[model samples]
Target chain A: MITIKDLRKTYDGFEALKGVSFSIREGEFYGLLGPNGAGKTTTISIMSSILKPDSGEVLLNGKNIYTHSDESKRIMGVVPQEIALYNELTAYENLTFWGGLYAVTPSELKARIDEVLKLFGLYERRNDKVTAYSGGMKRRINIAAALLHRPRILFMDEPTVGIDPQSRNLIFEVIEKLHNEGMTIVYTTHYMEEAERFCDRIGIIDNGQIIAEGTLDELKKNSHARETVVVNFNNLNDALLQKIHSFGSDFKQVDNMIYYYTNNLQTELSKIISQCNDAGGEIHNIEIRKVNLETVFLDLTGKQLRD
Target chain B: MIKLALKDLRLFVKDKRSMLITFAIPIALITLFALAFGGAGNSGKDAKISLQLSDLDHTEASASAIQIFDSLKNVNVLKVTLEQAQEKIKNGDEACVLIIQKGFSDSLTAGKELPLELQYDEAQEMQVGLLQQSLIPTVAMLPFNIGNAKAVMRNRFDNMVKGSDDSVHTQIHKESDGLFDALAMGVMQGSGTADIGAGFFGGDIKMTKLVAAKKDNTLGLVQAVAGTAVMMLLFSVVGIGVGLLDEKQEGTLKRLLYTPMNPINILLGKMLSANVISIFQLIIMFLFAAIAFGLDIYSHLTGLIITILATAYACSAFGVVLASFAKSRQQVQGLSTLIILVMSAIGGSMMPIFFMPSFMQKMAVLSVNYWSIQGFYDVFWRNLPATGGTFLSRIFVLILIGTLLNSLAVMMFKKNILKLS
Candidate 1:
């Protein structure tokens, strides 16, 4: 388990992270979600021991990692956003090299390398230079390198950005498998869908602070606009669409989907039907679904997940 | 640590630029020097000159002067008639002409001489001066020896008792031969004290002539080539280091740094790989020049090895420092080029320390290259002992550079990588 308290990182007079606090329980897969410049990278760097916090205490298993950096680093792993790989080296060679950085013996490293290689599906191209590997293959090796020592907790910042669907799925499967094997993970990403599907819990970070943190259902419950109801009418004209937009503030038309962000799905659905019924527009398919994280984010911050 | 070194070695070897800059170019340069430089030994085998005799004396005595040019080495004897010779002077066929006038022999026999016109192109004064200078020595030898011989023959005939043993000429020949042999042999015996390789023993090595000043002795040339080999070895090592920076910038270093091993191990591995590169470069350059130019590199192979070892350490350490300080591959290149150019310039790689200003020479002494070049000069050119104190001192300087630079590189890398400084 990792515990962060009163964590603050300041450069000059601008604060990157300000008095943030959080904890990741043992064996929990946690996602740190934020937009650009949300201090996700800075926070991760501090946890990885690559940067020191201005005022903070990070405890790993009841031990202050800052004070006992050497011992704390033994079980810690970090996979940076960038592909940290030597292009000239073969996949196996790169893993073996990374394996040596930890306390793994040569025999131990060989076994671990085989396991990770097989898991990442990089076994076939293990002997080929990394320069020849595709973007996804490189990303797999990057993650495999982080798990060389089988750390209790692995920190990966935006691990699946810019990967193809197949490779992305492979990565997602690997993460799920690791989580299932009781390896605690601190995964940071901007992909709302990935966070919604994968994370046991997530911290929605904004402007270097966690604006909200909870399980998927829990965060949605707090966000009053938890359900989105939408309907389309072929008879709806420009004036009527503008009049309907005034009735449902968050309603919008694009293609055939009318997006309605709402707190009460059934009540808002009835309101939409009665208002459009008098306006003489036909009601197309009308259905209700619970709001995901993006709605909670839009409700909380009035901004898109990507921005 | 060993893991890092192996990685560095493997990457460097796979890099084609490392092979090209460090090994191929140096070897090619050595081969060029060997094939281009013709051995400049003056054994009197190939010489050329021309002669124009006026024959004004129309006597055998004056004509005998013409025969002297034939005995000289490489003297192309062109016999030009007086009118032809005069016209040739304007056309510059010969550098100078020896015009023998009428009564020249009579004037000489009368113990006086006529002015022998030396007709040459007035516009080519320097050429005329060279021709005249050469003639002065040759003319002096002929007149002195022939006059002396003729006087002796005349005196012997005047004293001849009709046939007072006509073997007088034979007897006198034997006596003259004995005296000449005694004087020549005495001079030779006096000078025979010089050792065969005295110059190589750090004595008078320069057999430099008035002409061909740039043509160096075979030993000295070999030694200079050895110095060049050491210089380029440093460059190749730095090139290898720059390559390491490329890997680091590409994110390879960060991954490697997180290994369970000590960072020092990684640094040492890189240093060792760089050392290997430098050593390989030196070997190839030396071997190429040694084989192609007939250079005597083996004269002090052990000493050269020691020098190579020292220079390799220094250059490798330098490479580490460069790699550590650089943030990107381009920066690595800029910094290495700047440092190498400065080191090469100050280290007597481009010019011998002997020719540099004293201040510059003192500065060169502060560089690793100076010691390397000095070591090579001593061992290869001077053929000095490997255990000589000078060679040992050079090795010390190189080791010092290695130690200092290696430590500094480690510190810089740690600071920058940790983002502490």
Candidate 2:
């Protein structure tokens, strides 16, 4: 479990983290979702004791990480956005080095290295230098290195960024397995789908603030934006669009497509299709979906997730 | 910390380019300097001074003088005509020329003054001095021969008149004949050339004696090896520093800080690796020199080991400080290259410090290489016994300065690198 209280960090004349705060329960996979320069890495850095925040306290099980750095950090592992591995060293060697720094015993260290190398499917190339590995393989080894210490909590910052889909799936599966095994994980990424699929709770951060934080359904329920229903027509006219707009104020029509945002998609679908038929337009298809994190983020921050 | 250092060392060892830069290049340079500066195996031969001789006198006395020059172990006499001798001296082919006058033997036998001509080029002052000193005793012995011949003849005539016996008269006359040949031989050979005429020409003709120093050539060999080795050690340390910068850029340094290890421990680990590698580099170089060239590095065992430790630590600390100040790997490389090369050149790595101008030699004291090379020289070349005075001063200064620099580097790393990032 981790608690970040009133974290504020400044660089030069700019404020990177403006009094952001959050917490993660044990055995929960929490994802900090944000775009580039949204200060997710900064928050992770401060919480992991890699960087000291200007005015904040990161408590690991009720111990301030900065004040009790070693004791607090002993139970944590961090996988940075970058590879953060020695290209000249083999995967096995890199694991051994990281494990050794955690003060793992020789026997335990060897066992852990073997386990992680096997887990990451890098056992076949364990002896090869990291420089000779593929990007996906390197990312796998990077995660494996963080796992060598068997920490209670793992902080992975954009672990699957720029990696192949296969590697990304492999990483997702690993994180799923770890979460199922009751491991506390704090995953950060800008990929809304990944956060939706993998994270138990998602925190949407923007401009150094946690703008939204909740489960997928909770976020959707909490956001004021309604579910969108998109109806495509073979032929659409302005009169029919106005009639559809009369059903709800939150409506827009573009080309042969009409969008309707309502609290109830099922109740609004039939009336919208009947109105389109009355206008002599044949309905092509209808799509009904709840608002996702991207919409929640956009509605809350007035910016796209990728922005 | 030890684990971190070992990991860094393993990484460096695994990288072929790093190994080449740290070890292979330095070894090649050591071998080159050894070969160029006479650091190969001892051949058990003292350096010889060459002399050009023109025997225009052609008499038995002059012939005997030429034979004396030929028989001397430290002098190599080359036979040349007067014109050839003059040409050789003008062209710097010969250090000096010795020409025997036409009436030299006649003048000597008549007990009259005779001066043989010695010609040399003024530009070759050192060679000219050595040749002049070598010839002094040979020239002074000429005047002593007349008095010795007169004494021997007087002894023979007194023995015949006193009626000592027919055998006594014969013995005295034979002894006088032997004395004349002995005197002729002495007059041709220089002092210290024949122990038979020891002190015979003392204080005569302001005769100069050559004092051979047993340490000069060996000192030169050690300086060449030590200077180059220290210079290359700096470059390798800079390489390690650049490696630190790379790790920092890649986020490994920050990741390490996230562990239970202290920031000081992280830097100390890197410093330890650099120091260990540098020390090993020096050991390999010294061992190669000793095995291949018979350099007596182990003669002062304590001094050599201590010098290696102090110098390695100091250079490694310097590298860490440089890395701490740099923001990128390329910046570290460019900055360290210029600084290390300048320090090495000024500190006597590319050439002997003594050969530099006096001000440059004084400035050399500021460089780590200067202190390291001087310490090695004290141990290997001067054979200063490894006592406290000779090398310990250098060791003390190195350790003190290294500690200060390393502390600064650690502080800078914690402030500028970790906290700022």
Candidate 3:
């Protein structure tokens, strides 16, 4: 288990992490969800022993990460957002080099390399230079390198940001398999659905602070954000838009569609239907969404999860 | 299209290291080499070839022969005893020794030549070869001693005619005496008039030029030092190119810190590799120098090793400092090329420091190339003993440079990499 207490970091007088605190269980999947510059990376950097916080204590297992940095880093793996790899080297060579840094025995390293390459489906391209690999393949190899040491806890920062759907799905499968095999993973991503799908518990970070943390259901119970009632009108003319606006300022109109958020969607839906009917526009379709992570993020920060 | 070409040209020029290497280094090298060698090519006018003369023949003819040599532009005739001449050649003080045998003049006049010995240290191959070539034309001038012989013959014929009675032989001898006088006067007076037989009359004089073993010689040491020092700079640059710049740009350098290894160890490991490679470079250069230039590097083995290690340390330190300042491999290449070229030019590696301007010579101390070259020069060129204070001073300065610059580079890297982050 890894624990972070009152993590604070200031960079050039700008606070990147402000008194942020969190913990990861031994075999849990924790997702940190935030937009850009929301301290997700800063928090992960500190947690993975890559960067130090100004005033914080990060304990890996039972040892403080800073005081026992080498021991802490030994059991932790970090897959950076960027592909930190030697392009001139083959995939096997890259894995061997990183493994050597971890002081893996030669025989064990060879076997582990073969195992990891097969796992990542890059065994066939083991002899090819990393520069020859595709973007997703390169990312897979990058993750494979971090796992060479078989770290107890893996810190993956936006591992699937910009890749094809096929590659992304492969990565998701690998993460799920690793989590299933009891590898404690601290996954950071701004993609709402990935967090909702993968994370056993989620932390919503914004403006260098974690504003809320819980499971999907628990967060929904705590958030004041209502279910969204999206209405598709046959005619979303100015008359229908103005009549819908009269219900509340929370209702938004987009071509032939109107969206309204309310604590009670049933009551608000009736009022919206009456207003649209009065404006001479018939409602074609409607969607009532309960409070999701994105809704909670919007409700707390008045911004999109990816904003 | 022309505007696009102009934009590309601007971008190329904006890469300051590349621009400096392309335009500045070559131009500076050319200018400096021209300045250094231009005067060296005309060195014949400034310094004469030193030849020690041991004239065992005490005759007037031998003195005249010596005088003839003194008048020549190529040879500086130093009159020493045979023992002194041998010592001078052994010590490499003189290029060669010329020993005129006891009957050198008599044998020349009698047309029975004796051996004229030319002694030289064989290790001074280039200098000895040049001096031997000059000796041919100078020695060929010996047949002109016939002028002195003719004067002696003419005097004898005059005395014979004065003492004899008026016999048939006396009358014939008297008649021939006028012809003899005319011929004798012609050989003596016209000898100075026509310069046709000027340089090559000493061929009939049998001479043996022997290679003498040198007792304490440091010939070709300067060339060895100069060549080895320049090669060390190249190795340092290559080391930096492959090690620091490549790893940093590849992100492997930063990633190495993620391991259990300390950052200082990583820096030291890179430095150690560079230093070792540079030492090997110096060794290879010196080995070739010893083979080709006939340099006796092994004569002062301890000094050579110390100098090599010191030079490698200093050059490798310079490489580390240069790499620390650069942001990318391209920058390292361009900047190192420019700096190395400039250092080699101002230092004694590209040319002898003496040949450079006084200001450049003074500024040469700022370059590590100068220190290394000067260290080698001190031990080899100046023939200072390897164990002396001067030799120790050179090594000390190099060590100081290595220590200071390496520390500064490490400090700067730490500040920029960790503190800035």
Error of 1 at B289 (Å): 3.5
CAPRI grade of model 1: acceptable
lDDT of 3 by residue, A1-307 (tens): 8888999999999999889998889999999988789999889878867677889889887789888988877888888777878898999999998888886889999999999899888898899999999999988988888888888888898888788887788889889999999999999987888999999999888888989999988888998878887788776777667766665648655466666778777677787667767777888998887788888887777677777
TM-score of chain A in every predicted structure:
0.85, 0.84, 0.88
Model 2's i-RMS, to one decimal, reads 1.2
For each prediction, how big is the interface RMSD?
2.8, 1.2, 2.0
By DockQ, who's the top model here? 2
Please give the lDDT score at residue A243 for candidate 3: 65
| Model 2: residues with Cα > 4 Å off, grouped in runs | A229-289, B1-212, B216-219
Q: TM-scores, in order shown?
A: 0.65, 0.67, 0.67
lDDT of 1 by residue, B125-145 (tens): 344554555555555433333
Candidates 1 and 3 compared by TM-score, better number: 3
What does candidate 2's lDDT look like per residue over B173-284, in tens digits? 7776677577667657753433333243331222211111134335456767888898888888888888877877787887777788777777788899999999999999
Model 2 interface CAPRI class: medium
**Which parts of model 1 are misplaced by more than 4 Å?**
A228-260, A265-290, B1-224, B355-359
* Residue B267 lDDT in candidate 2: 79
**True contacts recovered per prediction:** 0.45, 0.89, 0.42
Model 1 lDDT per residue over A1-307, tens place: 7898888988777788988899999999898988778889888878866577888888898888768777777787888888988888999999997887788899999999999999999898999999999999999999999999989889888889889888899999999999999998998987888888789999888887888998988888887665777576666677777777767467757555566767676577777778777666677777665677877876776666778
| Better model by DockQ: candidate 1 vs candidate 3 | 3
Candidate whose lDDT is highest = 2
